[model samples]
Target: MKNKALYTLLIILVQSLHTTALNAQRSTPTEQINPYRIVERCTLHGISLLNNLDTYLSGYNYTGAGYYFNHENLRNAHTGNYNWKYLTTFSATLGYTKQQSNSQFTLLASRYWSGYHPFRVSNRLQLWTGAQIQLAGGALYVPANGNNMVSVKMRTALAATGIAIYRLPVRQHTIDLRYRIDIPLAGIMFSPEFGQSYYEIFGLGNTHGVIKFAHPLNSPSWQHTLSADIPIGNNTLRIAYTANLYQSKVNSLRTHIYNHSFAIGFAKTIYKIKRKDSMKAYSPLL
Candidate 1:
């Protein structure tokens, strides 16, 4: 594992060095156009319609808390045993971002979801799509349920992604594609007091595995999701689906269940924010 980490770092270092050398060779000592002017041709800040379906990728850095209600655990409170049903598990998320345009840094902490639900209102950032390399980290809190025994499950995950988005892209705007991974943060525990008892009901007889979660367990818990947004003028229609492809559950005492979501939502584009001064300075002259 250590060697693998070293190898990955080495590869990245080499790639960066190679890119720098290439950029040096391509450098033109002439004046560079203002980014804002180049993109300002479109009326919107950086959003337009997706005339062609190009690649889309988005990543946000998160530092918000959310609650997840495990229906199975709730059901066991009355049934007194484990089950295989996961319906509605809710979690709130808060994220920060240092965004990029093309291959350059542009925005820093431009926008984010609110503490409560931010979906009720129409946010322009939610409507368009673009391709980018994203890196995110966040936590999920599962409330403590007594009796049957369920701990406050905290988890974090990471993923490298590529997206093929279908939007009406007219300007230099950002968009969301699909969440390809919710990699298992670790082999979590579900109230050890009641966990062993719960495992017995699952026919495991006895459970023997790692008792703790390795903070950001660098394990293979890859997953995938699909979501789309169809634009109709300023308003849009959206539908999304997500599910787990791999199960890296480490429930030694209790049973763990994951659910698939098929959600239908609406999106609309509003006034785009003004272009930053730096961006405008880089725009090309007509």
Candidate 2:
């Protein structure tokens, strides 16, 4: 009886050791799912309309290109869901009209704080409202006018911005449709008189009230952009159209510039490492 009991105890010990060794070999690995920290998009614009107006009133139609860069940081706070966006754009147009040749170069920078709200229209719909601070400075060179050959422009304003976004899911593909608009409320702009020359302002030190306060009533300007994103493999393709309308009357000189651009670009997502049980990748739907 003692020998039989020893054999059974040995069998049970060997079985326990085998089970433990298998478990150790098959242990799960530690994984982490992190969020995208940065996103970069490059766009090439085809400008179709480049129109300008002065006392002589002329219009030009041609093709021009520009670049746009944007950075967004998102965070959830106790107050609400908010994000910060910084954008910069540089564009130049060169063309000629019946009256004269019109060329313009524009540089703009804007920073905005946008808060997202759930839209009742649908579960996939969202609306964002925010305030933006922008600084825009540019120059327009009209070759016809010997007196005012170059028009120097500087504008800074606090503007209101809004965005509407909707997502559509088709099988395994998702598409994002979004429209954004900005209107300047109030700010300061620099303009010269009807016949004032640069030599008079800087060379002769005759600058008085060159800086004028601007509002929608006086300087009505609007900027609108409509864009769509479609996923292609791991990256996204963006198609967009942008329209800019600017008009202001200061120092007895009337100015208006209208620009329309069609843009195509690619979107990329940036990711970071997180510590968790299983490794995964995460990205925003928009």
Candidate 3:
């Protein structure tokens, strides 16, 4: 009887321990199972049609061909919301234009960072609204002018941005159609006064009226992007068209830079795993 009682106690202990282990496994957090972050990177090359007019350089509108390179990164925000994402973009452009014997060149570089929150409109459509901060600087070179050959451009702005995405299924593949637009709300810009030479502003230390407040009335700008992402094999190809219209009137000088570009790019998704979580884990379905 004593031997039977001991055996029964052992069996009960073993069963209790097994039950506890199973319960712990079932209660494990979802994040521990999916310990990786996903990031999408894209690089694009494009040709641009540029229309530039800078009264500081000349009274004529300079029109010509240009080229641009764009790189972007997108990732889910760390706020634990799957519908929120962060986007960063960097772009550079070089343009060349000519008028009667005068040739002009423009070099521009810009960076944008945005945080977007998405609202599902339907099973296949989503609308994202966001705010963007933009930093842009450039210089226009006119070799014909002796003293005032370079017109500098620098600005920073807070913008309201929105994006619409639609998913279309064709046969066995899906295509994502996206449209994005950005409008600057308020900002500050650097501009020299009309007929003011760089020498007076920099060399002579006459710094008055160089920095100006920008608003829609003084500096109206818009950026529009239309793109389609098509899945091919294991990769995604993006074809895009972008229109950028920038204009500012400050210090009695009027300036505008317009560009229309067509771009082709590829996007790749990367999974980032921490060293501690090097082992494979079960990923949740989307």
Candidate 4:
């Protein structure tokens, strides 16, 4: 009996020692699953030198000092008849950004201030407040049909506008799209080009209904937008010749406008950011 008890205690001691050794070995390895730590390791701070900073913001952010080549016209009652012309004006958006992302779309709230159009027209001096919505996110483009590269974007605002930017894969890098939206109007400013608002041009007669539903008035801009771009890239620099042409209707009258900017820009990957969801890799083991 004494011998048997000694053997049992010895076995217990050996087992405890083995477990302690195994635990110490595992402890030395510092196996961890910390997402914050991984994020810290990947954070890259600085401007992306290779990227064309000017084009980086794309349409979302207006240039600090913007120069627009624009065209506008009024047909009879601004719609029943169609008159379209353009202008070339120079101005700057108070708020500016030039950001480009590979996966997610960029959202920007900016003020468009310029009174220049390229097309020779009756009115040469024009000024107003406007906002721009652009697709600043990068995505995969699939060849859909003749002279077009197609990409899908889902927008939920005012009237959930669906935007499909079609790139006319011509040797020129023109990006075009036919799009539409139904959002209500918000934050409008038609102060004046130099202290005289549109109210002065048309008096104030049926301006009530007309004010809320026409160009210079009906900024309730919800229409399918079509844009185009041309390429001006070479070995040293990347240049994109870009143009945007859109036609949308309000209150049964079709309104159309065209804008094109010659942009020279490029971009390179900044740094890869590991998401928080990767922590789940260790979940099942728990």
Most accurate candidate by TM-score: 3
Score residue 219 of candidate 3 by CA lDDT. 98
Please report the candidate that would top lDDT against the real structure.
3
How do the residues 215-268 of candidate 4 rate in per-residue lDDT, one tens digit apiece? 324333332223232334531122333333322233333322222334333322
Could you estimate the TM-score for every candidate? 0.32, 0.68, 0.83, 0.22
Worst 10 residues of 2 by lDDT: 277-286
Cα shift from native, residue 242, model 1 (Å): 1.5
Deviation of model 4 at 28, angstroms: 23
* C-alpha lDDT score of every prediction, in listed order: 0.31, 0.63, 0.87, 0.28
Please give, for residues 1-286, the per-residue lDDT of candidate 3 as tens digits: 9999999999999989877865665466335433227889999999888989999888889999899888999887656545587989888889998766889998988899999998999999999999999999999999989989999999999999999999999998899999999898999999999899999999999989998888889999999989999999999999989888899988778999998888899999986766444332322221
lDDT of candidate 2 over 1-286, digit per residue (tens): 9999999999999989877765654363234332333434444444435556654223343234445443344332234443344333444444342332445443333444444433446778887666667677666655555766677768888888777778889788989887888888999998876667888988898888788999987789988978888899887887877777778987777777666657677765544335331132221121
lDDT value for model 1 = 0.31
Ranking by lDDT: 3, 2, 1, 4
Residue 156 lDDT, candidate 1, scale 0-100: 36
Candidate 1 local lDDT, 92-187, one digit each (tens) = 222121223212111111111111111212343322121112122222222222232222233333223323333335465434453323333333
Which candidate, 2 or 3, would have the higher TM-score against the true structure?
A: 3
